[model samples]
Target: MSGRCKGGKGLGKGGTKRHHKLLCDNIQGITKPATRRVARQREAHLGAHLRGDAWDVAGLTPSHLELIYEEMHGMLQVFLENVIHDTITYSEHAKGKTVTAMDVVYALKHQRHTLYSSGG
Candidate 1:
């Protein structure tokens, strides 16, 4: 028989057990005030950059901006989730302890959102 024990729960090295960290509620971080602030900033930028009398005269209501913000926020959340999930998958497949920029690039490419360059 070999020196190593067989059919046993082997805690490698110093017998340290790995603990899985719990995921926090990230959605909670995007508070109503934060969303409002972002929406207002976007509205201001658009108002400043857009040309033509129609765009100049037309203004978005506060409620309209909020709705638009919610829609954009949801889409952004989904996109980030997909990208992060794919990045983690690639890292794990390569037995990597940390995610790299290349992992993100590859993940984006996998989702048909490829970037032209990964530099800097």
Candidate 2:
């Protein structure tokens, strides 16, 4: 506590837990101005300007297509599962046991979608 920053009780009797210890470190001492390289790295992650928007057929590879399809399929599966989960969780009886195919079927029927349309 002797060498610690002023105005905060040290992590001890009547003091905040260790989780808040960092808050006692004065921001002036903790923060530094960013170097040019760090700033450029951050910009590269986010604000890189688009190259010419002309038809980039050269970029369209089968692997890229497959990757896109895989990501889309994974997202669709997550959404469908969420819908089924919400439906089951909202029900009184179905909320208790392991969700079965019958439960999903009933939910989809009530929600007016086919089993395949439910995607599970």
Candidate 3:
């Protein structure tokens, strides 16, 4: 049997095993923050890129933003899994043996999301 992994790496059987391990790690957030301070710092750094007028600072407190970010992160984790599963299904049906960019595009379309490309 061909031992290629879903993401197209072709290191044979060991690659397949490693791919599954990586996928599981990602879905389980193996690198996620272990404390509120880390989460807060991440959120603050993300916000630092915004313009001075980008947000109404008086509106949302740091605590509120942290909770919102936490919720958003959880929702995105589930969405990410769904996307991966759909892409795998699409690739398998096409008999391609690997998930390609088009497979991801179609998978997102199946999930009711469209990705736009920018002209260079």
Q: Which structure among the candidates has the greatest lDDT? A: 1
- Most TM-score-accurate candidate: 1
Off by over 4 Å in 3: 1-19, 22-58, 116-120
User: How far off is residue 55 in model 2, in Å?
Assistant: 21
Model 1, span 1-120: residue lDDT tens: 686776655456446568999776575468766765665665776785543443231387878766766776787688889999999999999978799999999999999977886752
Q: RMSD in angstroms, all models?
A: 6.8, 21.2, 9.7
Instruction: Give RMSD (Å) of candidate 2 vs. truth.
Output: 21.2
C-alpha RMSD of candidate 1: 6.8
What C-alpha lDDT values do all the predictions have? 0.74, 0.53, 0.68
Could you give candidate 2's per-residue lDDT for residues 1-120 as a string of tens digits?
Answer: 586566755456554445634343232231212222433454565554733332233477878755654554555456566766656764647544466666767677666654765434
**TM-scores of all models?**
0.58, 0.32, 0.51
TM accuracy, model 1 = 0.58
Q: Specify the poorest-scoring 10-residue window by lDDT in model 3.
A: 13-22
Q: In candidate 2, how many Å is residue 27 off?
A: 43
Question: What local lDDT does model 1 show for residue 14?
Answer: 47
Of candidates 2 and 1, the better by lDDT: 1
In candidate 3, the residue pairs with backbone N, CA or C atoms under 3 Å apart (3 or more residues apart, or in different chains) clash, namely none
